[model samples]
Target: MAGDRGAVRRARDWTRDWGRIWGGAWHRGDGTILAALLAAWVLGVSVWPLARLFLEALAPGADGVPLGLMAEVLEARSTGRAFRNTLAASAGSVVIATVLGTVLAFATGLLRLRGRVAMTFLILSPLLIPSQTMALAWIELSGSNSPVLRPLGLAPPPGTTNPIYSGGGIALLMGIEHMPLVFIALRAALATLPADLVEAARIAGAGRLRILTRIILPLALPSALAGAILAFAAAVGNFGVPALLGIPGRFPMLTTLIYQRLNGFGPSVAGQVAVLALILVALALGALGLRALVLSRLSVPLGRGAALRPLDPGRARLPLEAAIWAVLAVIAILPMLALVATALSPALGVALSASTATTANFHEVLANPTIRRAFANSLLLSALAALVCTLVALPFAWLKVSARAPLIRLLDWLVDGPWVVPGTVVALAMILAFLPPLPLVGSLYGTFAILLLAYLARFLPLVLRPVVAGAEALEPAQDEAARIVGAGPLRRILFVLAPALLPAAMAGALILMMTAVNELTLSALLWSSGNETLGVMVFALQYEGNSTAAAATSVLSLLMVLALALALDAMRRWLPPGTLPWRD
Candidate 1:
C-alpha cells in the first residue's frame, strides 16, 4: 500500500510539471495582449488630451514665439482678477480648513469618545456631499426663511444682504467643504505616533497642552500642512461653490471663467480657455510638489511602536465630546435640515410650517420631463462608467502586480495624473482631444461618447486602486496551482483571480458610481443639449431663479448619494477591511 501511494504521488508531480511547462508561455502571451490593449486605451483616453491641451495653450504667435495664447490670456485684466480671487479665496479657506480639521482630528483621533464611528462619519460628510449640494444647503441656512435660524431669530431680514455671497463667504463655505481632507491626513498621522516619544514627553513633567504643543504638533505639522495644501488645491478646482456663490457674487475664478467662456462662445474660445485650464493644473501640481517636499523634509523618522492610547481627559471628557458633537451638528446636520425645509416650503421666501409646507416643489421637479431625463442620464452614465472602469481595472491590476510589464508600472504613475489634477482641467483636455472628428469615431464633441471617454480617463484609477490592493492580498499558491493544472491566463483569471478580486472591485465601482452620479465639474463642461446631468439641473434651476425647485432637485440628488453610501456600508461585513471607509 505504501509503494502504491508513492507511485501515485510521483505520477501526479510529473503531470503537474508537464502542465506548467506547456502553460507558462501561453499565459505570458495572454498577459502581453491584455496589457497592450489597456496601454492603448489609457494613452488615447488620457495622455493624448493633456498633451493636446498644452500644445493648444502654446499656439505660436505671428512673431513665431510659442505660448502666444498664454501671453494673451495673462495680459487680460479678467485673467488677473480671476487669478487674484482664486489665490485669496484658496489661501483663506486653507486657514479655516486647517484649524477646523486639525481640531476635529485631534479630538477624534486621540480621545476615545462615545459613538466615534458616528462622529467620524459626520465629520467626513462634506466629502460625500456634492459641492453644489453643500453650497445650496449653506444658502438655505443663512437665508431669511431658514428653518433652523428663523426659529432662533438668528436669520437676517427678508431683504437684508446675505453673508454667504462674498469672498469671505466663499472661503468660509469652501473651508467646511474641504475640512475632511485635513481630518483624514492628520488622523492617519496621529494613528502612527511613536508611543515612546509620547511617553517620554509625559514623564518629563510636561502637561497636556505642552506635550501637544511641543511634541504632537511638531510631529503632526507636516501632515497638517500637506492636508492644507490639498484643501487649497481642492478649493481652487471647486466650480460648484464658486459658480453658485461667486457668479452671483460677481467674484470671478479660473474655473467659472473657463465655464462661462466656453458656454457662451462654444469651443471657439477653447484655445483661450486652455490657458486658464493650464494655470489651474499648474497650481494643483505645484501645490502637490510642495507637499512632497514638505513630507520629505519635515517628516520625522520614528521607530515602530504600539499605537497611541486614548488620552484620559478625566473631568474634561464629557465637555470635550459635547463640543465636538455640537460643532459637527452645526456643520453637517444643520445644512441638510435647512435644505429639506427649503424644499418643503411653498415659496422661496416663505417660512416652513406644518400647515403651509407642501410637496409641491418635489412634485413639480419629479414631474418635469427635463429633470427626469437628467436623472436617467446621470444614472446611465454613472453605471456605464463604473462598469467600464471595473472591467479595465481588473487586467490593468493583474498585469501591474507582476514584474513582466514594466510599461504597466510606468503607466500606473500616468494613471494617477488625471485623478490628481482638477476635474475642470481633465474636461478641457477631453474637449481638445475629441472635439475634432476622428477616424471612424468622428467628433465625439456634443455627444455622450466624449463624456464616457473623459470619465474613463478620470475615474479608472478609482477602481484600479482597490483592485491592486486586492490582487496583492491574493494567495500566490492558488495561481501557481492553477498554472500547474494546465490553466491558461484567461481561465485562471476567470476561475481563480476574478472571484477573489470582485468584492474590492465592486466597492470601488460603488464609489465611482456615487461620485459620477452627483458630479458637477465634468458634466458642467461636457454635457450637451438633452444631456443635462443632476448637477447641471440644479445649477440651471437655481440660475433660472427657481430656488425652491433647485432645492428639491438638490434634496433628491443628496438622497441618491446617501442611499448608495448606506448600501455600501451595509455590505461592510462582506467587503475587505478598510474598503468601506467609514468604520474599519
Candidate 2:
C-alpha cells in the first residue's frame, strides 16, 4: 500500500511539476552552452597550439624544402640524444620517486612510526617551493666553498669535484622534489587499506616483511604507480631543473631543448620545440592510460570501514621511527638551508665570509622595479585564476550532480583529460587557436589572458574534484524542502547549496592558486613580455646568472605560499559549526 501511494504521489508530483521538467530541458540547453565554452577554452589552450606548432615545423622552407625535412631534423644526432636523455631522466625519476614515496608511506601509515605527523609535513615541504630553488640549493651545496659544510670537512677543498652539475644530480633533485606527491597519494592509499585483510594476514602468521612484500605492495601498487607516472610526466616536462643542472654539462632533455629553441627565437626551431611538446603530451597520455588500466583491475572500493590498522613493530619501532624522521628532516631542511646560504651569499660564487652573507640580496630585490612588478603580477595572476577557476568549476560540478545531460555526465572526464597533456603543448595550442582574424581575442595572444586561460584548462580538474565532493554531500531534498517553504530555485541555491559547498569551493580555490603561483612549465612558455610573475622572474634571473637574487626571490615566493596554505587550513577548520555539509 505504501509503495502504491508513493508511486501515485510521484506521478502527481511529476504532473504538477511539468514546469520543472521543461526547466530541466532548458538547463540541458544551457549545458550545451557550457560545453561550447569549455570546448573553446580546452581547444584554444590544449589542441590549437600543438597543431600550429606541428604545421610550422612541417612547412616548406624558403628554398622549397623537402616534405621529410622536419622528420630528418628530428632524427638528427643532437635531437636523438636529447630525446634519449629526456627518457632516461624521466624513467629514473619515476623509479626513485615511487620507491621512496611508497617506502615512506609504509613506514608512517602501516608501521607504528613515531613523529609521523611531523615527518609527513617535512616530506611535503618541497612542494611548497619551486624546483628551480631546489636546483640552486643543490648547486650551492655541491660547491667547494659552501659555507655550512666548510668547517665540517664535508665541503670539497677548493678544486674537488661536485655532484650538482651531473645528470645523476638532476635526477636526484627531481625525484626528491616530486616524492611528496607520491607520498601523499600512497600514504592515503596505505591508510585506507582494509583492516580485515591485514588482520587476516597477521592471523595467518605472516611475518612483517612478508606481509609488506606480498600484501601492501599489491594493494598499494596502483596509487603508487599513478603517483610515480605523474612524477615522470613532471620530470619530463621540467625545464628549470635541467636548465640549472643539465645544460651546463651539455645534457639536453626535451624541456631544456625547447627552452633553448625559445631563447633562440627562430620559427623553425620553435616549431620543432612544439613538435617535441606534442610528443611529450602523447607520451603522458599513454602512461596515464596504462595507469588507468592497471588501477581498474586493482581498484579497491573505499569506505569508512576500510581504514588501516596500526601494525605494531614490537620492540624495533622506536629505532625505525627515529630513522624515518631523520631521513625526512634531511630531505626537507638540507635544501632549504642551502637555499638560505645561496640567498645570503654575495654572489653565485659562495664566499664564506660573514660580510658576504648580508641581507643585500633581499634589499636589492626589494628595491628593483622588475622584482616589484613580478611580485605584484604573481599575486594578481594567482588571485584572478583562483577566482575564475572556482566560479567556473562550481557550475560544472552542479551540472554533473543535478543535470542528466550527456555533456554534464562527461564534464569531469573533459576537465581531467588535460592532466595527461603537457603544459608546453597546451601553451602552443592556445597560440595556434588564436593566430589571426580572431580579431579582439587574437590580439591578446602573449598576454596575461592566455596564461589565465591555460591555467583554467590545466587546473579545472583540481578545482572541480573538491567541488563535486561538496556538491555530492548536499542532498537534493534540501532544495526540495526549501522550495516547500516558499523559496525559489535561485533563493534555495544561494541560501542552501552555496553555503553547503562553500568550504569545498574555498579549498579548491586555494589549491589551484598554489599551483598557479608556482607553475613553471606552461608559464615558462607563455608568460608575456611585460607580465612576468615571480616564477618567470626566478628562472630569468637564474639564467641571466643572478643566483643570489633568484634564491632570494624563491624564498619570498615559498613564504607566501606557506602563509596561504596555513590560512586556508585554518579557515577549513574553523568553519561555523553546522554550516558545512560534511560536518552534519
Clashing residue pairs in candidate 2 are 48-429, 49-428, 49-429
Model 1: lowest-lDDT 10 consecutive positions: 21-30
* lDDT of model 2 at position 17: 99
* RMSD value for candidate 1: 8.3
Report the lDDT tens digits of candidate 1 across residue range 44-65. 8889999999899889755677
Worst lDDT window (10 residues) for model 2? 575-584
- Model 1 regions lying over 4 Å from their true place: 1-30, 62-64, 203-205
How close is every model to the real structure, measured as TM-score?
A: 0.93, 0.86
For 109-191, candidate 2 gives per-residue lDDT tens digits of 78766666567667777776677777877776677767566757788778866667877877888888889768877876876
lDDT of 1 at 105: 92
